[model samples]
Target: MKSPILRLDTMKFTYISLLILVSPILFLSCKGKFNFSKQKAENEKIVVQYGEHFLTDRDLKLILPKDYTKEDSVNWVKTYIEEWVKKKAIVDKAEENIDELTLKEIENKIVEYRQDLLINAYNNYLIEKNIKDSVTDEELFQYYEKHKDSFPLVKEVVQFRAITVDKSEENQAERLFNSSKDEDFDEVMKMVLQAGNAYHDKDSIWYSPEYIAAQFPELNQNDQLSQLISRRKVKISDENTVTLIKILNLKPKGSTAPYEFVKPTIKNLLLNKRKLNLLSELQNQLYKEAINKNEIKINEN
Candidate 1:
């Protein structure tokens, strides 16, 4: 979790220097190419600056995750620095060009936004500190069973092996896959890999019918993927490659989604529900206390 900003000195570059450092890279963009190791300076590296406001590398570190690679962090710094520059430039222009009353409106809006942000942050902090975030397996299962209708499958999902090989090896590949006596998917995959260039052989994972259709357009020749089952072995040929697909299982729409696949989703929903309940309880308790102390007054005419 080391900070990507190795040299704090380089962040002290002038506004013009930053432009010079970032602009030429637009002329040549490539993955793993963003590097700031060379931009060493005795002064701190200033990420973005307008007048006296300076956003440095350490400031950017607050928002960027600690696990980002040097390449990714450098790119993120460039993007954020650009946004910072544009925002400051526009806001400074608005303050200079806009009238006093309109400026006061903008000031009030900023205050409102800041207040909302603070409240939301504090709420989130309290939830993380006090709430039991983990949802047990039993809890998730019970929730899913009770609300199975809410998690109905909307898309046709299937477990299949898609083996794609060169056009010339189509017949041989299909013969091997169909003729395999092995029960294990790995064994089948090994057989396919010997002849095919690439494969999708995860028998455990279910994929959407749309995904299968896209991967092997031949699947859409007659009946759709929903109608196909594991016993079906399909051969699809294109101009360059041949695809051999075996549909192991098919689960049509309206069926309950697999519990394992939606565990994280269910956990989040339960956590949010808990937070809402706690918030309601807090509000109610405060209101009752306020009424007893004569702090709350209602004059309904």
Candidate 2:
């Protein structure tokens, strides 16, 4: 005859096996009735229980990643269960210790946050459905012209070409760098690339003076670096390397920023203005429709 303890252990094992076998069927049947409210049915299969709160296997499925490996799934489920227990325990302790009035205030704040989230989401959906995203170049230019005073240059900006080469090849590079011919510029660029030196040929893009100075430490250290801004061509040499810079354009600090530099900002500003106007129109249209349908009634008592 089996001992009483042995029989009890066998019964426990059987119970767990049955629970595992039926869990999927139970989950499917109860899936539609799964309510997120504080109230829970007494017969629900609880995975982790803390105080009055519990997490069901169904809840775990909802939050768990579908693509996890078998080992990863086991580890993740264990960690999630531990965290849920700890969090629920702490929250239960807080509710028990804190005053009712403070809890009510927290609930009110949660409600307000939900309201804001819903309104913002609805506004974004309406904007996406109704608004045309394209902004013309003419619109951008007009906006920049009107808002020129708003975007003063905080730092001096420059448009320039620069090349750095080994000291041994500086004489040949200097001749190429000073040449007005396009072929000479291309050859200089090829030489700079082959020797694995820094070169900047973005004549259309504006850069801060400090950015150019960084490539040539000698220029950065010079107190009269600003004086070099007026020069069309500049050459600086060190013990190991020589750098040649050709200034294409310069904008002084406090002057209006160039149109190309601020074009992206102007586009963003115009888009935002259009969005606001669309939202305002939506609000007015809704108000009028509500009044026409007798959905809104003003009460004076």
Q: Pick the candidate with the highest TM-score.
A: 2
Q: Specify the highest-lDDT model's number.
A: 2
Q: After superposition, how far is residue 134 of candidate 1 from its true place, in Å?
A: 1.3
Off by over 4 Å in 1: 1-112, 126-133, 165-176, 179-187, 194-196, 214-232, 238-242, 278-301
lDDT of 1 by residue, 221-258 (tens): 76745345544666667798876788777777788887
- lDDT tens string, model 2, 1-301? 4433333234444434443443332223443444455655575446544445656555655665666654454456556656665676678789899999999999999999999899789888876786556689998898888889999999889998989999999999999988989999999888999999988888999888788777666776665356568776778887998888888888989999999988988888887888888878888999999999999877998
Give the runs in model 2 whose Cα sits over 4 Å from its true position.
Answer: 1-83, 90-106, 126-132, 165-169, 180-198, 213-242, 297-301
* RMSD over all Cα atoms, model 1: 11.3
TM-score, structure 1 vs. true: 0.51
Candidate 2: clashing pairs of residues = none
Cα lDDT of candidate 1 equals 0.69
